[model samples]
Target: MSYFDLSKFPPSSAASDDGSVSSLLSISPRSSRSIILDQSFFDAEDPSPSPRGLAEPPPQRSLPAINDALYSVQVNNRRRSTNSNTTTSVSSNYDSDSSGRSGRRPIKTGEMGTSSERESDGEVRYQEKKSKPKPKKKVSVVISGGDKVKRNGGIRMAPLNVPIKRRLQTAAVLLHGFTIPLYTSLFWFLLAIPLTWPILIPYLIYCLFSEAHFDGSAPRRRSHFLRSLPVWRLYTGYFPLKLHATTSLDPAKNYIFTYHPHGIISHGAFGHFCTENTTGFEGLFPGITNTLLTLDSNFRVPFYRDFLMFMGLASVSRRSCEALLRGEAAQPPPTWSAWKPWTWWRLVFLLPIFHPAPHYTAPTGGGRAITIVLGGARESLEAIPGRMALVVKRRRGVLRIAIRENAGIVPVLSFGENELYDQMVPTGGGMIEKLQMFVKSVAGFTVPLFHARGVFNYDVGLLPYRKEVNTVVGRPVFPKAQMESPRDGDLDEFQERYLAELRRLWDEHKDVYAKGRLPGKEGEMVFVG
Candidate 1:
């Protein structure tokens, strides 16, 4: 619709030769006439024509001023359209036009190109704006595979298609876990049978009065056959345990091997020391007879006691430890003649009947070594997966024994021992912990509420997860000579040196062995009394 009334506002006297009003308006301001419209035209869409005096020619301006004003008006109009719901003021546009005529406009994001581009077609340049591309942010990604997996919150169910050999390995460990119960049940079952009383009664009497367990010249019932069983290899394979000795132990010298972080079951110590098939302890340190020491109270159990002695395990009692160490200096155990070729069939049956008494078959000679779990029962309470805490700060009995015997103290640290079980440990000084402590004070051992994988499922059972356990034996710390009466100061000095060696051993191999440790402070090696 036409808003201007052309009838009243005729062409000005200074119009261009073409007689066009637009041509006159486009002239340089210096030679241009002022064009004013009626006030009514701006107030309404249709307005009455103004008086003829409004058509009179006005003052002129230069061409440069005219061009600058046009540019300023165009820029102002563009800004006004971009901003929503805003009124444009003609006075402000004229003020800006009058202020600048030579300076270039500042560049902005998503704006038109350079001044050269603006000098061409303003409409085309405004349409061809350079849109600044938004910067892309980087993201980190993690990948999971067969060996390791991101734990989704749910029960970890085991796959059905497991190999038969792996299943057998799991079964072997399962048997070991149930040894005490299984043997005790068997003993009671046999006792229930009245016909077996004659043999069983004598065995019970012998077990009760047997100095053979504590006197420790050499374990009479320590069966080399049982220690070197193929089942031990399968048990080791369940968690795929390994042993690494930093240096060879001398055959002529006695050594005290102290194990750290007494895990719930101490599976690493059992698999490494008590069994010959796991890491070939004998092959690693030949001529040294190592006896794994356990609590003396364990000897009270009937069948389990015999089973432990069969695996070359001894009591950790003062008498037993001293006896084993003293036996080393005395005569070695008696040896039997080599088996003749005719006994090949009996050997194939895997029986312990022969009592193959080789000179080095038992903990005999001066080359005897005793392995003690230095942390004992208290440390078992801290057996959380991917974490370790040793109760060795004030426990100096084993160290005192080492000093008195003039034995080398071998520091053994087994990584992943605590990863065998998931335990529900109560917070320190809590009611539950107080109750646990009370039980421990009376029973000599604290019961850890723990669990792990099952026979069929990967979660919710007693079987330990398929984790790798690496037991690294550090260099032995020994005094200059034996001290039958070591002073408190001397004991302190020796213990500091021993503790230093233990910390060094941990620092050296923690990265490789404890890669899967829990995060933050809980994952660290804590020492407690």
Candidate 2:
């Protein structure tokens, strides 16, 4: 998320592997020419003067000087001979300086001085300036384009010489990736401890019955402190997720963000929406309080459930969606007895079930947003390493919700999301695919058999491989007007426009962000039902 600024570091005190003195010098490119100067440039009096007493612009103010040895090192590295074109040519007003007039003039380029002219007092001053060692400063200059000295090609393991800070960053991401399993194990382990049952049982009851997720009020349990943790920066640096907003979103209007191709875990979605500091969600879309929507079943897990809620994630059900967009409270949880299972069956199923609603409420939209991964778990099955496909064609539910709520629909395309993991994708209508669909029908979510790099090793584990994920937020497509009962034609028209915008976003950024994408059809973005 942050670039390493070479300016902050001290100059190297030793020689580099290439047999060149690694000392940093104040070299800057001006007019496509590398201007290398010695101690004469920073002296009390300028040795070189401007022609005809006119002030020529100074070489763009250089970085702080470090070592005198770098002067020789830089000159040798360029491998250019001192001449009319390469060396620093000066225009001196030696006669004017001798007559007591100010001779301080700017540096210029031209022919070299005569041997007798070079041996003048100015030359003696230059010799004195070089002989006396100038104090080294604790500053450096960043190369114009990039300062990354060395890079290796192909897949390689983390080098042993990796910095401690980078290692800690990897650790932070590893901890986050195992959050669900870690919390699950911790929850069961706590249950085993009879002494902690007094605390754990009540917490378990609260996690199971709390209607906090459904109410759609500002999440009281959502810990801003936790979400703003420094660890999220490392998590982001793991894949180094970058968020791009194509157009500024209006805070007065509500938005429904449709995230595509739920890659493995939808890490892009979580980083961009769930946490503010990760992708600078707050700064990017100012005044908009966006809540990431996930499967309601996730709240069924014990400790892991609490973790999701704390991250400001809400249920992706009709009631929660409606409540959030309306900026109003949802219908209060209905009270029912355990003995009368028949009476409370609807209450249990209706509250969390993702049923499409035809009824529309009076628009009371504000600076609120609900981010839904359009592809969901079904599309996750198609998440291969280098391919980009989405189960998006049939998913018009978000559009309908946006129409009813009078909210803008923002299509988000995440490049390199599918490259995070390798999955065992079944052939079309194959037995494996059929079995996966059957499970999804029964449990509402299906798991894709996937694997990636390990903790310490770069092979065989659940940790998503280190890849760059760029999540681009396209312009919001607002409804023409609020409609109590939107027509099918209207919904289709909106969907068409939304899909077109999404495709355009892909085409605009695919080459830059998806260069690693597979060749031909496998790499092309496709829509499926």
Candidate 3:
């Protein structure tokens, strides 16, 4: 018999009572012998075997049997002591040991077999046991000023340290989004005459000199000159923007950066391009001169032309484009002119012949770059926060410009650019739409009925909401020279290729930076020249 055989029995305590008990009985059944167990048997209970019809013995029944076996051993010892008087005590002790050994052997064997059978049948029998629960600690609370008060049965509380920078940033964001726009509008309205006059004067001059000789430096610097005013900085203080660039851009390389989804006046573009201290423009792209292009009418004012140039702005005219592109290395000091006297007539007459040295020789050299809001003012009316909808319909002029100038095209996608202002209605055609289009065609920019947070209130005016702006610069697209105008078929193919590259750039990094914002759908490069 093997140890696993449950039917095998061990030696009985009754066998020790008679001399007739054989040596075989003393040896017990071979199946009852203990052996080193398999590790798997102890680790996991196998459930493949089915249980037999025999039910497990009740606890009460097993306990009485155990008690009886112990009682019998005591009774046999007592009888042995009486039978031999002097030697009886000694014999009784031996008999008691033999009985105890015999009884315990069967009990141990039975327990082992039962446990194994139950485990094989997947029936686990756990002895009922309960553990005492741990006592709760007493909590104590300290009260300020004169008394140390004990509370919550003496429980101790840990101190929490809040980060000061994170708290301040959150506060700044709330203030910009909720309180700045109202103050900005109020300030603008109060000083509208003074502000409007300065801008108005140069704007008229630019229009009068529309076909006149072009001098690049004066006009470009005047556009951003308003930033120098202490009052203007106060207005922008409510919504401060920080600019950072991943790589340095060479100024000598003429670049045409196409900005998308024209936000209401593109406050982001203005902040980044027009101001030096705010955007850190000089630090990021060292040696790369940038001009944020504006409509020709912007430089028409008398005082505004000088102001715009001071602000680093220039006209977005084709003539202005050629002049800047063909401009000299660095302007000669104003005093070192061949035709000195610096009169308006002399400056105007000498301008055409006084071509400044080329700012850029090779496309790869350090040169000036132009940033065009390609979506234009119509796109501004359609601008929705978190979604980019470019207005490329019939807008092949930019492509032509790229090819003509031999400039590399850099598509710029700005996330959260549109989140700044809430528009009058949803972005499509209607009576309002016709009016906006007419205004754009005549005035160069549409007046968007937009609103954002005020300086002292949560709503009202044309300021941008306090949302992070992430501007991604796509890889450059080099233009191929063509002797003649591109056919419709060739144009379509080129546009398709350009759009594909743009979409690829958006797809790759959009998830990394714009996880929460709505994603742009399959963009249609609608040509609406």
Candidate 4:
């Protein structure tokens, strides 16, 4: 066998090879004699100087020819030194023993050296370890009862959700439709029988006689006995409105207020002009009694007629308009000693009845005025929630009314009125549009398929949503009074001036209330007949 030199192997492999040899020798390297033998008998420990001198190499130690040969020599040398040291320790131990029982004891092998036995032991160990099982990991407990567990383990209960304003609005709507008419009829009936029957009875007889016998075109004295009903009060209180006057309205002068974008039903007109709900109208412009004109057909409704008349709501017919504007002021009863009278009662009795003649006349010396809703039914259909698009094409009728009456046309712009109800289907055009027009034409007002909220729930009902309505009364447009029919050019000029004033009103105050809306459409005015 070729003897191998020890220095050519890597350090880790050489050390491992020595460990295997000690297992074959049946001696533990940990013994004292093994330590001594390793220190004194290894090749590195040979102390003799080289034959050439202390620094000279050995003369004929040839380099190993093959790589394996070099590795084998290194491994063999390491094993020889380790085995020799372990054997010395074992022999010394045997000599020192008093009882010779070494042959009877089992030979101990190192863990790494005995492969088959370790494999068998590993199988047994793995089986035993597998059978023993791992302990379970702890899981967090969530004790859910009344306390709700938040994602982070905190507890909270849900909050209550309710709409209080919607309930109030529903109450208002119910009061307007049901309770108001009942109360007004009772109050008016009591007053007519007890005190005013004599005057009212004669006036009605004269009105019937004149309307039937004479040329119904003749002028007549209008009564004020039943015009102070609480229904109007209830109607006005339903909205948040403020009446601001740029200039004092002269009571002696006749006037016309042309309300624009006639919302749903001219609710703003009913609240602002016909009723004294916003501010004390009698106090604001003393002696100035205003009437909200409606379609003439409204006077044909059974109970609604009396209720409307009691609230100072008259027909917009030519006869009704003239009669309301030219009627005489009510004279106070002679004698101041009757006991201090109720101011509201006295005003109700004494305020002038504005009954102008059936022919639309320029104000007497130019003072009489009439108010018409410029947008009419068509614009009411265009009142979409959160946006306004006026439908006023060929709407020079209001200009004509202003010019013919010589009444300074005051344009009233109502913001937030469109937001009151959410229309169910989109409005503009289609089958529904045609149907809406047909119904409006026949019934005098179209019922928009709209929903707001129930008194408690947000899902369904006829009550309007509790949106704030701010009706802005724009600056008055005083067109040049013409004696004869207004010429085509003059009518065009009046329309332009009126439109400009309306646009200015919207620009000045739209931001104050309608801040969330897209900017008013550029030149978006749509004129209608």
lDDT top scorer: 1
Tens digits of per-residue lDDT, candidate 2, 159-185, equal 455567667777987888788889999
What lDDT score belongs to each candidate, Candidate 1 first? Answer: 0.70, 0.67, 0.51, 0.50
Off by over 4 Å in 4: 1-170, 178-237, 328-369, 425-429, 519-529
lDDT of 3 by residue, 77-105 (tens): 55655675723221121122343532112
Local error of candidate 3 at residue 91 (angstroms): 99
lDDT of 2: 0.67
TM-score of each: 0.66, 0.63, 0.52, 0.53
Candidate order by decreasing lDDT: 1, 2, 3, 4
Top candidate by TM-score:
1
lDDT of 1: 0.70
Q: Which ten residues in a row have the lowest lDDT in candidate 4?
A: 32-41
List residue ranges in candidate 3 displaced over 4 A.
Answer: 1-207, 210-215, 218-252, 328-366, 426-429, 482-494, 519-529
TM-score of 3: 0.52
Q: What C-alpha lDDT does candidate 3 achieve relative to the native structure?
A: 0.51
Steric collisions counted per model? 4, 0, 59, 29
